[model samples]
Target: MIVVVGITVGILDVCELGSHFILMSITIACGMLSEAYARGPPAPNASTHHSERQIPFAACDIAQLLIALCWGITGDIAEIVSRARIAQLWAATGVAVAYMSIARWLGNVIIFDRKKSRFVANAVYGLAFVPYATSWCALIARFALAINGAEASVPDWIIAIVIGMFFGFTGTFPIIHALSINRVIDVDAAEVAYAIAGVANKSLLGWYMWYGVNRMQTA
Candidate 1:
């Protein structure tokens, strides 16, 4: 229902503001919910065995890495040489982070059987859309751009790598939580796996983005 409403409003421009982000959040939230349902209820005597505990965390880590790589490459390809590129990257990152956070929150609420007031749940859902209209993501992008401006001739690949790494690292927490909610892995082991995957993903994406950017800059 939440997903359907969000998609409808986004398509119809019912809110006319930040509909993209709202739709994204709703999609992610729904994905999490579906996964939780697929996993069914936790066993009453569920015990975390060593191998069982490791598998989901490992899988989540791999999934996050792939997701990060895809996003990073897409951003790199979309980036223009103007200052607006920074803003674009930041906005994209903010949306990704927001989606992950909302999904994780929803998953946690479902998994733990915690009750939330309708107002509170709606408020949490609203957080995903806030970044779309907020200046904070842009501000952060500006700060980052300013720091990087000192080195004008830095290779495009180097810049790509740095941006990918930053966003990838920042996004890990929520990814882990989402995985946990899906019962993919125990939450406690998620940090290490997700971190490792983030690093790998970002590093590869940086190289790939660099290649693309270099080609464009030289052309």
Candidate 2:
């Protein structure tokens, strides 16, 4: 299924979509690593506790950083665009880590009571995506522009909000699915939904950034 999705997305445009997928993969990996770390190590019984194997968080984080660097290098090669400096890239990564940490914290606090209607529950979860995506877009755009020596504009914020809402709406799919399956919503469940939705959403966002945003810039 992932391969099929990747092939379809790659067909749209390789460099942009590929870069987006790489970044999303890194984020997802980090999330999973963090979760595993929180869960602790597996028991000595290898057969019974097979699912408990986990990579160290520090190792996963370093690997994710390297992946980002490689993606930047690939983007530069494919697009003939200047890559962000290593320092800038590191800064952006720090921002991302901080953002995810906050989002997770927020998810923990904001409970979606199962007693509420699905519409209400979904709406609550959907609303969270607005700010989450918006801030992410804004930070990335701002940093990219700054690194490229371009002036930031008001439209950047507007564009971020538009894209954020798009992601938010699309992101509701997993949450709705989870709700239907479990008849309730919780932080962990919602986080899983968000992670799942992220794969698809980021793919679409990649295409948008490549075709739509890039075209607008050239025009």
Candidate 3:
């Protein structure tokens, strides 16, 4: 399944190795996050709670950063034009990914009762995606401008709005956690859903952004 998805995505004009490798990494990361949460922290307590969350979150973040670093270092911009500009874009994305990752773990630690509170938990966690979404929107704009040598596409704004909403949706994992905490959803089901969302956000959306950029760059 991973290979199939990777090959499909790699069909786009880009660095095939980097694209395939990153897609595979994201798939594995999604599974790791789901499994880790499903197992429910090695020891759940106030003192160790933050640590448990940080480990898996950090692993996923590292995987994302690795791909960004690979593209930046290797000049692997999908279209191969303006290597310097694309490198800057990847650098910015790396920073945003790091910010988003930090916000995830820290938000959970700072916002107590994240799994218990109905509204506050979901709201707080959802805000963490702000950086991630914003970066991508900007990336799209700048990338389009670079490729077209003109104003960014008007449709880019629509894509930006959709990306924002999508990230907002992704951050609602606290709801899933709450469901598991209250036993409203069985642990297995919650984990499976969580894994699906993780894959969608990290792997699917990431590919969408890259593919979009590739199309613009090549067109």
List TM-score per model, in order: 0.31, 0.29, 0.29
Error of 2 at 174 (Å): 23
Each candidate structure's count of clashing pairs:
0, 0, 0
lDDT of 2 at 100: 39
Superposition error at 192 for model 1 (Å): 32
Local distance difference test, each candidate = 0.40, 0.37, 0.40
Candidate 1: the clashing residue pairs are none
Candidate 3 residue lDDT tens string, 13-55: 1333344235444544543443445445445455544532332
- Local accuracy of candidate 1 as per-residue lDDT tens digits, 1-219: 433343343343323345444555555766477547645666667653421222122234334434544553344323322335453453345334334433443464446432334325444443444333223333333333444453223443233334333335344424544665797653323332333234433443334333322332233
Lowest summed lDDT window (length 10), candidate 1: 50-59
Tens digits of per-residue lDDT for model 2, 35-86? 4455554455644222222212243433443343334323322221243354
Give the candidates in order of TM-score, highest first.
Answer: 1, 3, 2
Sorting all predicted structures by lDDT, with the top scorer first, yields 1, 3, 2
**C-alpha root-mean-square deviation, candidate 2:** 17.0
